[model samples]
Target: MLPEVPTEGRIPFLDLTIPIHWENHAILMFGIWFVLVPFAIMVVRFGKGKPTTYGIPRGTPKWAFPEVCWALHFYGLYTAILLALAGAGFAMLLTGGFSGSLHAWFGVGTIGLGVLQIISAQFRGSHGGRKAPTSDPDDRTTWGGDHFDMTPQRWWFEAWHKTAGYFALFLAGGAVATGLSQFWVLGIAIALAVVVIGGLITAVVLQGRGYNHDTYLSVYGTHPDHPFNRRRFAQMLEEKDRKP
Candidate 1:
């Protein structure tokens, strides 16, 4: 278990870059880009896997991914807020308004992109006829809805979301590099971390993009009449053999 954080003597956000609060800055920076961002991507990736062993007919995509996405969105949202707040704190402490550093600009860009992402999600509706039918009582695919955006708009939304995500991740890396420049982080270490993190995010996002309706339903079709049920089909075959 993690050690309990002491309530008293907590370093104020404005003191984030002070020598005494270096650890706080390090922790916050790592928490946002490394932990939260990767966790969100992994959770969505996990939804693309088969869940036959668990007997979850809807698989992780239908039942678990949305729930995870909902929870992780808060992480992304608040982290973006914290990034802005930290910048504002720094400005208040020293710069009086905004630091003209490239890092500061990148941080601002990240927050702006995150806000755009959130707004785009609000307009998202079903993707063409791709939405899971609600007429069936057993329908369990739960991510999009029947009222979702049109294909062309959804396509643009996806394009923007993916592009912005990558840009934000890169900007976060730049921000961390600048933020930690006075610290012990080596140049080589930063480079390696960026490459590894960027590669992983790219891979996971690509994998998620490949999980179209056919791919998803093939692995975990929950519809009552879907032909994807191998076990049920086998049983039916066995019963038919016995009947004659």
Candidate 2:
């Protein structure tokens, strides 16, 4: 609690009261959601076939990662935006304008997540492409190439991603439940937790099947790596040979 006495009717900078619910708001919305969204998306995308090789898409862009288990970019962006908003709101709260405990906690949680999002984006966007740090490097790739280095392995990357996913969900859920007292907020928080958890479980079960990395990189037809599968390269070759 901050001292209410202010000299000359002005609260001193050192006496600013901390927002009551900063941890819940910032940690939950930004911190948790920042990591959770991408994790959830990746679980669906990569886990579609098998946990390791990750199933290939029937039709996929050549630039895509085959075993991408989730799309964290969305979560990153959403968390960042929320972080900014919460920071502003926090300023108001500290200056004696706003004073909702729920709002404060959520704001703090969200801001923490926003910082994480920025860190992740910077790491992924370093090579001028949106490839994550764990993505496999294209065999023919270089610094000036159109892709970055990231690949799925049974060790580090998977562990980081999975741990982040579970932790984020828990933080987001618990923050809402414990920090906020409003009825509507409670309902929304519980609903969000349920949705995230359900989606993750379903996607993981779907991923147990064998995943083929080449499948996700094929453009229009079967992958060259696939036996008896016609390839897009054949069409490209044929088109190139056509006389104008």
Best by lDDT: 1
- Residues 129-179, model 1: lDDT tens digits: 123344233433442332221245555666786687778777777777666
Q: Write the per-residue lDDT of candidate 2 for residues 1-244, one digit (tens) a residue.
A: 1233111222356764443444344354534453455454454555433322212433344335533333344454555456556655555545466445664565456455545644544433222111323334352132221112222232243345445544654555555554444323544556566666876675566556433233223211233432212334666778889957
Best TM-score among the predictions, by candidate number: 1
Q: In each prediction, how many residue pairs overlap at the backbone (N, C-alpha, C within less than 3 A)? A: 3, 37
Where does candidate 1 stray beyond 4 Å? 1-20, 49-95, 127-150, 183-244
In terms of lDDT, the poorest run of 10 residues in model 1 is 1-10
TM-score of 2: 0.41
Q: What is the TM-score of each candidate against the true structure?
A: 0.54, 0.41
Q: Candidate 1: how many backbone clashes? A: 3
User: Would you list the C-alpha lDDT of every candidate in the order shown?
Assistant: 0.52, 0.43
